[model samples]
Target: MAHPSLTETTARVQEIIGSDAITRIFRDAMSRTLRDAFVHSDGEEVFVLTGDIPAMWLRDSAAQVRPYLPLAADDPGVADLLVSLVRRQVRAILLDPYANAFNARPDGAGHAGDETQMHPGVWERKYEVDSLCFPLQLAHQVWRITGRTDHLDAEFARAADLIITTWQVEQDHAERSPYRFQRHDGPPTDTLTDGGNGSPVGRTGMTWSGFRPSDDACVLNYNVPGNLFAIHVLGNLAELATVVLDDPALASRARDLAAELAAGVREWGIVTHPVHGRIYAYEVDGLGGAVLMDDANMPSLLSLPLTGGDAIDAEIYRNTRAFVLSPDNPTYTRGTHAVGLGSPHTPPDHVWPIALAVQGLTTDDDAEKRRILDLLARTHADTFRMHESFHVDDPATFTREWFSWADSMFCELVLDVCGAGVQSTLDEEQVPTP
Candidate 1:
């Protein structure tokens, strides 16, 4: 099979989607990352900027190019691009596994004033667990979709070890971890509590994360969604270690950690709500403190079906989904323009395009998916591209005019609706649940 050109792919998508306006938006979104956000270095590394930030986020960079994974199977060029990204991510993880974002060069750029163990190559050391998970997920997906193991080289093995050790240390964060962040002259969410140590957390087998995927400080350290994502990615890493690396020890370590995290989530992350029954909590402190509201971020409670894979309870997820999309979840917002999940990172009464896209991708209801897609098209504020977020009442009032991750997610959702969805490796394996 010949690799389809961008033009050919667009035409193929147009057949499924009859509307010309939507087709135009889809084409523009399909090319946005490559044209505006991607930077291929002379040293064969690919750095993807998170749109208007001029910095590469470990999570956003992987997601920005994910919609092109299907093309990578047939196109060597696309496959090479994905491989380069994995290489770059491996280097970034080796540089600082705790850093969420990095500079294209070791230029000492981005938030140097923040009180953390700052490195010249690191853009922001927010220390979100999802930051480490995204790279592994991308590498596994590339190999699964393209049958290429070139990205799973020696450096990746070392990085995988570091990631595992880091998570293990974080499982006992107060005693074993050395991560701290304190930003002066910023919002409260920009810095951690207890002199940058974050709020104290009781020992749960789940790993600790200082920040949410939204880059905001966590009220409670044990982020349920982030740990769920970590469990899924650990399964990916275990498969890679078993099949590609031929290291049974590493595979066993990954599986054991995954089981521990799964046990922690099962014991501490689910709560019996009066209205929603047994639903997953967004964040838990293992000390009877749990936040039930869902954010608009990728690993949010509303996104458990997409990120949590088979480990997620079907009936609980259905109940949780109902609670999150309704007025029950504090962040669930409805206005004149659209109704969906929002984030504390954004202003109040705003809806995130990424959340809308996730809603469309995770649902089996065709009408609901189409409704979310149409809502996204109507709320782009005439940019023909997705933004970070827009006001629920007024679509024009938005933030971050250029966000590549949001655009890529929109493209993925559109492809999903068109029945040409990108394949993901996260759902291929199930984490052992207690």
Candidate 2:
């Protein structure tokens, strides 16, 4: 059954958007996750699959349902769905803090052949920092938007502690952590280096991430964008700890960790490019190696304003944004139809709709946003749904015909342009200064 609120919201959007194509895509994208991706498990848990993939990625699931937050405030059904998904996420974290995706059942499903610590309930064992950060982000968002505390039960508190501990262990990964991942007969990015321990790195206060949000191995290890996202999420966890969990110790720990990561990023993440001036690097080693490109994924350098808000330096972000959107950045692609950020995860000259949506959401220019919206409306391959990536010159050539996260991102950008976007709870005061 469709949520009544979603039906009513779609009707309102139809009244606001003038283009028939835009309205049709907006309605489909807005309800895609509920209609196609969500799977109700036992009890109140709801497992949300990343479209076309049978597994549930912690980061993708959180993003797939985020556009529905505004409707969650007034609709009981929407609120319950959000709450249930958070509960499910908390359980997944407790199962394995290092796993990025999970199986709905403990049937030893997904990547069981990969060389790593594989659990029956885990879909993939690639440990990305954003995987842990996203669950906390969703839990906090659900609480903030719906004023619900049932999702933040004792189980959630336990999961929070495990998440913090896992991050702390990963801070000195060479000596303290025992996590390793290896895959045979695959691309180099599918596996880590140095006997599955990943590349070596010095002691930067920022935690080490074996993989990026793109599910590609990190070259420099200490991912700056992932750390920045972790810093923002720690602030959210601190607020949740103090207000709901009644645990000042946990709150202080989260704040201290956030401060440490922020200090690390300030010292090592910024690079003085000749053209872009001072801007954030994508990845860095404490010993002075940095990768100066961004991917088309969440927690990317281009998404700083959307995720970090006023916590980031406004002037530096402006410079960084200018660099990432231009040809200066290695992954920025330009063609006849669309120009946006592309990912190493996909083929050359293929731009992601997710990046375009993020670009529209973070911009201040109405004309720029409208231009992006028009481009998106025209380049859906007549499927009326967003795809993972499409050819820069031809919309007919695309990847992942059923990508739920990209669809949700498109819906979010459209809603923002229609003056109905949800405000992030990570305000200036809530986020730590970097």
Candidate 3:
């Protein structure tokens, strides 16, 4: 059989699923909007949005279109577009290593860049560590899937070094760096303390993250899932150094960092669940304190598999899963329209489609997937687009005018179920990579 373009495959799905079917809903959503959201308009950079946030969050943009890596590989135009996006992100880091978000083009507002502003788009600038981790993951994944390395250039290497330096500084935040954000528009409790600079902590091996992967402020000093992602990021860095750059020294450094991070997680990031007995914590301080519940975000406890953490011990993960999916987890919510998790970012009753898609992707039960699929299809409000979060009880009141990450993840989960080669990198990394 011949490989089909996304349109043809999507046509097949729409054929099987009524045009308004569960999976076809998101397929059509992306069909109408993804190109515009992702393609660089006005020749700026292509930093996708989450719903309608005008600013391009470094983290969100990378994860948003990541599912397209495979599809882009097969289509040169899309592949070129992704490469262009990566280059734009690399430029942002070079301009301001501290800010995690950037305006696709400089508006003379962010930290300073010689690069000219591309019209109709400007990079949003805010510093977040995980933001640096994402472009490497995207570039590496695109290269791995496409067998193309045209975009990996001197700037990427320079960005890698800047990331290393930034990471090192963050590891010792008590003394090294000076960065903070305080959003006065929201409630004082709704925002971070100390101007969002973060609370202080002891010198543990764990790296400091000003923001969680959720792009929100961290309550505790150490974020377990973010650290888990850091471990994965370090692994990818090593792979990129070796596979694409042929820089064994950088690869070794990344490997050492990954080891250090894993050890830190072992030391500070896990706890003994009475039920699971040895489940990981959401965030930790290495000072005998840990947050136990999970959120509905990527790098979430639920997304262990998607983020490259394996369920090596089914019984333990099963127990942990039961705890999270049940009433025990604070963020877990259930309603007539949807039943999943919600973060503080949304109203109490609202649930994120990202979480539902993740619930579908991570669960082993067909019934659970179907239930989630049902909720997802019903909650889209017939725009055929996924929202950042829907009112779990109501399924209507959603946020964001443009959200590309949810759209991408929804697409990836559907593709995975359809045998679209969305291979888990967990197993590939479990053993040594040659």
TM-score of 2: 0.96
User: Which clashing pairs does model 1 show?
Assistant: none
**Reference-based TM-score of each model:** 0.96, 0.96, 0.87
- Which ranges of candidate 3 are over 4 A from the true structure? 1-4, 15-19, 39-45, 108-126, 189-191, 310-317, 424-434
User: How far does residue 187 in candidate 2 sit from its true spot (Å)?
Assistant: 0.7
- Residue range with the least summed lDDT across 10 consecutive positions in model 3: 113-122
Order the numbered candidates by lDDT, best leading: 2, 1, 3
The true-versus-predicted C-alpha distance at residue 1 of model 3, in Å, is: 26
Q: Score each candidate by Cα lDDT.
A: 0.88, 0.88, 0.68
Better candidate number, 1 or 2, judged by lDDT: 2
Off by over 4 Å in 2: 42-44, 424-434
Instruction: Kindly list the per-residue Cα lDDT of model 2 for residues 1-434, writing each as its tens digit.
Output: 57888888787777877778988887877666887799875664889989999999999999998788878877889889889889899889888889999999999988999999899999999999999888888888777777788999899989988888888998899999989999886899999988899988999898999999999999999998889888988898998898888988889988998898899899999999999999999999899899999999998999987676445788989899999999999999999999999999999999999999999999989888889988999999989989999999999999998999999988888778887776642221132222
lDDT of 3 by residue, 1-434 (tens): 12245676576555544435655665655564465565556866566645465566677778777656657656776677678888888887787776666554446443333122222233433455567777877877767666667778878888887787777777777788665555555444334566566676665677777666666667776777667777787788887888778888878877787777778877777678776678778877666777888887777878776664431234545666777787778888888776788887778977888988888888777677657666677778867778788887776578864577788777766665554535543223232346
